[model samples]
Target: MAGRPTIYDVAERAGVSKSLVSLVLNRSPSVSEASRLAVEEAIAALGYRPSRAAANLAARSTRLVGVLIDDYTNLWFVDLVRGLRTTLGEHGYRVTVADMATAPPTENPVEGFLSMRVEGVVVAMDVPAALSDPAAPPVVIAGTRRAAPPDADSVTNDDAVGARLAAEHLLSLGHRRLGHLTASGGAAVVRRASFVEAVERSGATVVTIEHDGPTDEQAGFDGAIALLETHPETTAIFAANDLMALGALGAARQLRRRVPEDLSIMGYDNTPLARTRLVDLTTIDDNSFAVGIEAGRLLLDRMNDADARTGAGAGATSDGHARATHRTLEPDLILRGTTGPAPAAAP
Candidate 1:
């Protein structure tokens, strides 16, 4: 049986100490360039393969990061994960993904991540209260506003600004009675509030239809049906997400309501679904890739400094302490085929 190559073999070949070989392989900044080169040459000559587990134990850290996502089927989530992988890979970290698609709502994803001994965790779902463990590894939450504990961090697009932009677009098109189809719960409420505020500022009446469940095509369809039925005067609708906006499009088609001519609809998240030739939904670009990239960077930073304070592990703070270090990206409106000038009033 062949034995594994040892660091001593590399050190002997390079004419360096075992510590020098270890430092080079572990990427320690303290090692000189000449020393690092010698270690690399020695490693090549000896055909040495470093043991990841042993290296982690020696350094008291690991390069593995665990990412938890709400739904794997959502293309936006897929893109976000891809962005995270690309960024983390550049930093010599491997990502382990866990899809909580079928998990019960009450299950603690953070606990699962902890079990893996992940140095850091990135959550692409709504923030969970159970993640408030100061002793745990750092965490980064995306796509939701639930504040991380003092020890965790988070990254999100400017959802309120995105909603305002969508509402303003309709208002600019002379939409008076505007209706909103939005997801239920925390993030949706913020978007709805922004939309209503924007409409109110423009002296327009805002009628909102809140979905009973998660934001999806079904919610969009059902919400649109209710809104159109209750407020026939509504000339425009702004959905919280592209999926819901697509649902609104389906509802309009079913009712024989000509788009842009009879109504204008806009959505957030500017996902690929909105760009389909069949749908062509006008939407606000939340830049999901950028969000993922930022989240990945935050995780890397945490890994670099294990003692750093993050929002996820710190729990609720006083107003002053709770001031979230949120990174809010601006949203741009992409006008496609769905949004247009408001239809003229019926003769």
Candidate 2:
């Protein structure tokens, strides 16, 4: 009457029970022809339209979204999840994460997510080879390019730009002798490659130490020690991530080099650790929160398109599978106390 008509109004107008009206709306065969006609007549009079969200509810929609990550120790996921949850929660979905490092080998993380009946998935790490199936659920990959499935939408950082920013920063400070501490991963490889190229373009020296172990503090420490010991003239260091940069700080301390006075260090990811008063690490801000928001939007689009193809409650019409989307965000440099002009050489 006052606003949009509801099922309750339709039932009251049709002189039937609310349950019977629902049965008609959902097209249940149990409703008699006479009752169906009565409901249709009542609906035509009131112009009642069912909500897709309500329809999904009646259809037993799961309303859950799963996120996959390699580990929890990486603080970079903190802001990413914040942005992701903000977007998905507004659309009536909850986000759940699976740490692949802790999952048993027998049960694939994707399988675990599917067993939980998640309507969609967001992969913040590498896309596993086992997930190349054609019938896989809707997915959005974050920060991966090479391993991304054909149908999965992707959101990634502009590693070339980010690495260039790092290189230019160090070079601007007169850091001719540079050292890079990195680990194994697609993101790491891209960053390392770009950083090396940018430094090489200026005819500067770059000593890269790639650790075979996990990308953690210890790897950073070991790599830094090796780099500094082998390239003692190296005046600047760039770590792959904030955790590694923190480890580099420790390495510098153990080696008796005063930060930004005797040596300058920079890191990537601009994680919360870089913002701390103690660490104060100069790093590249990958804009991961924005990447997460865009990723959430992309996954929603994929899920909605998939639903339309299967005649789901969400309204849309398309003939064939939707095309995948790929988005990349540019990164910025955050200056802090960790980096400075190259110190005067021993004279």
Q: Write the per-residue lDDT of candidate 1 for residues 66-125, one digit (tens) a residue.
A: 877656555567667777888888866778887777678886667877877787788776
After superposition, which runs of candidate 1 have C-alpha atoms over 4 Å from their true positions? 1-62, 104-108, 307-324
lDDT of 2 at 203: 95
TM-score of 2: 0.81
Clashing pairs in 2: none
**lDDT of each prediction vs. the true structure?**
0.75, 0.83
Error of 2 at 43 (Å): 12
After TM-score superposition, the amount by which residue 142's alpha carbon in candidate 1 deviates from its true location, in angstroms, is 1.7
Report RMSD (Å) for each prediction in the order shown. 8.7, 8.6
- Index of the highest-TM-score prediction: 2
For all candidates, the clash counts are 11, 0
The alpha-carbon deviation from the true structure for residue 81 of candidate 2, after best TM-score superposition, in angstroms, is 0.6
Global Cα lDDT for candidate 2 = 0.83
Report residue 313 deviation for candidate 2 (angstroms). Answer: 13
lDDT per residue for candidate 2 within 231-342, as digits (tens), equals 9999999998888888999999999999989889999988988999999999999898998899988876666555533332222234334577889998999999999999
Task: Please give the RMSD of candidate 2 to the true structure.
Answer: 8.6
